[model samples]
Target: MNPLLRLLVLALVLPAAACSTLSAQQRDRAIAIAAAARAPAVDCGQPDRCAEPSPLRALAGEAFAASAAAPDGAPHHYALLLDEGGDALLARVNLIRSATRRIDLQTYIFDTDDSARLVLDELLAAARRGVRVRLLIDQLSAIADLQILAALSGAHQNLELRIYNPTFNLAKPNYLHYAASVVCCFRRFNQRMHNKLLVVDEAVGIAGGRNYQDDYYDWDAQFKFRDRDVLVAGPEVRTMERNFAAYWDDRRSVPVERLNDVARRLLADGVPAMPPARPAHPRRVEALSQAASDPETVRTQLVARAMPVAAVEYLADLPDKHHGDSALEDGVGAAGLAGLLAGAQEEVLLQTPYLVLSDHALEIFRGLRGREAPPQVRVSTNSLAATDNPIVYALTYKYKRRHVRELGFDLFEYKPFPADPPVDPALGGWWPGQAPADAPDPEVARSELPGGSLGGSRGSAGEAQVAAKLRTETRPSLLRTSAPANRPLPVTGAGPRMGLHAKSMVIDRRIAVVGTHNFDPRSETYNTEAAVVIDDPAFARALAASIEGDIAPGNSWVVAPRAKPPVLSGLNYSVGKVLERSPILDLWPWRYATNYEFQPGPECPRPLPRRDPEFHRCYAPVGDFPEVSLGPKSILTRMLTAFGAGLVPIL
Candidate 1:
């Protein structure tokens, strides 16, 4: 059977399977239990009205107040979290452990993983200490973990949990049920809350792309993500707290106890015993403990270390962003970010796992390219080999070359682990920010390129022109080897492949935007997102340095014209070229592939190279297909994904 036809058949069949399954006894039992477990309403008023002085005020608050009161004080102070995964967890745990008044956390995915459990333990501990803990998680991913959530909410009178936009079908809240829900009610299920924020004591907050999950914090043995976040303090935190309050108060956010009787009954059963979380590295834990114990000293140290920012603003999408309301009126969605991007003067640095430029965004880029002094725009995103979402990759892959030649932006695709050696700590460490010593100088493109002349044709014509322009232009070569010039580099031992999951942008060394907003259609149209824009040259430069490190030759691959190989070489770069041109495959969202070598059921998986012990050389080139990690999806999931390929724009 044709592969395409098979995928279509699978998509249709899986939904039918979901409908046919009749766990009659289980469903009836669930209904009965839910009916009996109805929770009484508790009057938890507005978050702001409930606010109290942070205990830190008596301890750490003086230091922050002093910093803010200084005659030369900037509006905000920021610290960039360079630790790939561990440090982010440390920051959150420390904040929770030290909070005096309240803690508000809003996120898209709060998985029941080792890292998540550790954080949950801290929240529980904080609640025990009388700190108010409010957690708002998107229901899309949290539905399966209802029992755990119920237990958490029930364990502490000071803690409250809510799930956003929950589905009506509560018997089995797995992906199959969600898929069925989507099938039955596409519009509602299609929209999600994609916000990631953590604010403590209404004073300090952490925001970025990191979620509370194993993969997010580098606890997953199978995968790791190179991501970024910002530790922020000052008046801006109050604004972030209010944003959380708004979401918490939104009609879409339903308290977990209110998620129907069955869910409540399930919660009444108590959370199952989870395996002990892997202990955090001793140094990380020690740091967190010290910070938590001496909030004043830590605040002083943080203020001393923080980069002073001229201005800062928090932005968020409406909890009802799926309604497609104009962001300008509500100060949500991507309006603020879009406006910030449109004002770039010197350069724009974008780091996102996914890149699907909206029409407005494309126009912004086009205008920048058309400028007399066009800003040097550089974008670092996951290569086919490094992405976790092939469906989104398919959409962005089709526009890769056009973004390069037409938009005149330098594009770098992140390489999986072992492709690059261990990064130097001074340069950003494993998550390096300094460009490779041998990376093509950004100044070269800035100097040689004439104003609007570098721009190519738009759309398909623009894509066709890329090849010809690449052959003719004397511009700095965008195609370069992925390996770093430094040899026998320091290694972090062997582990799973590393992928880019950071969603950030630094513009003109004056503004930095970091949050859960991916530069994709889903973020722009279907889901709610949040980000903080700091208008500090120092902060922007710090972020840009990290971004620059990511785009360095050692960390990413430059997708350029394939080079001719020796006659004996049996390479197949042609496959990539063909895939780039094949409109049919591009049209079929689910018909995506990767180039990474897959060793299914291997007798012995490959080991790390002796010289490069930082990453295992687990994969080899597999033709020209682009590689992506979708985690451990079952047959039904694969089918749903394949079938839903055409829905990439909305998904």
Candidate 2:
């Protein structure tokens, strides 16, 4: 290792020993925190052990929430839609800061940025207070930094860490990392734990798309998102906790201590002793407008109403209907509006960041468009300018104009928010779920329509005009800033351009299923996805209203010729559209594009492997694509990278 890198690792490994020169109050608080970590596990009836449900069992609306429950059972959970900014971010962060008894965190990706660090610090503080902290991060997404992990584990005896599907490289006949992943193909990659959850003291849970990253939390000053999350309590706590335990105990998970020496030391130090916690950051009730003054709606609406239900493990031998056994449910049909596209619904509104629609998805929408109601189907997504993944943009852009014209659905594309001029008076704070009257007139904001041409998807002139307005009216300029910017926003559009992350559809405010599943083929067929479909009109109405009133205007643009495709987004946008249109075409010659390949190993029934160079290249992208480093390769790194490649399929 380079001297600088070696020194850096050592610095992380050995931090300054706890300062002996501490104030008496500080010491007392620290000691008190230690005691709380030893409290007995909050029991929620041990989570419907040995029970399971069929994978084919579709839980429509009410049935989905039926599984949510608290240990004692009054539905104290809340299910408010998080389609706005500022308040929602604060609400979730506040919840994490206040968690006292135990914090169970799991995620596919956790970036090591300011927001991530801030939350990490909060977890550490809670751990010091005797709060038992157990964290499970997806090894595929979390680049293992042993030194950092070791230091963190060593700092708190109350914290337990584990990695889901880990890998490391090696040299010789085979890399150890490769071998690990090969074994995980069936047990790990096929069944990814894609759920992002934060459960605290059995009293609250936060489940949604937000990862532990600055961009996700809207902490980045340059660009921020208007995303959503459900802060749940009640019966749902039992279900989520049960789900968590299944993944926790799964054979694919490796206690992080096995890899980090410091983690081992911390575990050896033993659990701390501490007092039990009362509810912290409890839920609050109010009107949609009231959510502004009352931030507790997140907790009260989402977490407060959960009640327990049957527990289902990943590979448990449960009833065929609710079984969580296979990597993906094959052949069996999924319930809901599969072919219902033939029947007319008044309207269909679909928003997705990754839009890789399959034949089934296309047919459903088209069928709906042909119905008697001739429902006005409106689809919204980022213009080429806003897409984070250019390839995904390419895949979906191809159908923009065609869908709008042929399917008769209005298409809306988002343009960047305009720059606010210096000394502009409207530097006002926003209320949750309500657009301020002082804010721009909502009507004046145009509804974004798709571009005009069927084959050529480009923003309409109306879109260009609206884009200009956003730059001048809604967006604030980061350039000529008063302080150092974490990330600089584009000179045009509002702040930074953030992609649409909400994965849901509100059908006349009568039904909604909001979960972690994206509207892409990867999410549908390749990855394991979970969502809760809510049928209650009251709740669904609230969800729809939030999206329309709070989310639509500023974040999106209202364009004309809803028939046209949006503007050209460059290579990423073009290619992604082609891929999206061709479901069978999985491989392309792009460097970082997503590819669908057959799962590795003989366990999967498919075409047999061959060593032909052309054949291998085509399939290589499916499994462990090779990587060559720029710097001199070290023995450990080469091994670790090999290991990483082996596990790529599962990761």
Cα lDDT listed for each candidate: 0.57, 0.43
Per-model TM values vs. the true structure: 0.68, 0.54
Deviation in Å, model 2, residue 442 alpha carbon: 26
What are the root-mean-square deviations of the candidates from the true structure over C-alphas? 14.5, 16.8
lDDT of 2 by residue, 3-102 (tens): 6865554454323212112445543443343334433433222232111121111111233454344354434334545543333444444555455456
| Per-residue lDDT of candidate 1, residues 1-651 (tens digit) | 466865665586466544533355654454344444333333334443322333333333544675668798645444554334644665576667667678899987776655676688787676666677899988766624545654554555677788888766342264455555665566787788888899987778888888887666654443457787777767778888888898899888876655553344553463333344454333333443444455454344333345545477888876656554533452345567888888889888998887877666778899999989999888888765555555555456665546765787666777654233222111111222112232222223212321111111111111111111100101111111122211111112233445688989998888888887875667777788888888877778877877876765445655432233323223333343345454444332222222233232353243322123322234343333333222342232334333444555673
Which model scores highest in lDDT?
A: 1
Stretches of candidate 2 exceeding 4 Å from the true structure: 1-76, 97-100, 169-192, 260-345, 418-495, 549-555, 558-651
Alpha-carbon shift of residue 411 in model 2 (angstroms) = 2.0
Clashes of 2: 99
Candidate 1 residue 11 Cα shift, in angstroms, is 17
Candidate 1, residue 340: CA error in Å?
1.1
Q: Which candidate gets the maximum TM-score versus the true structure?
A: 1
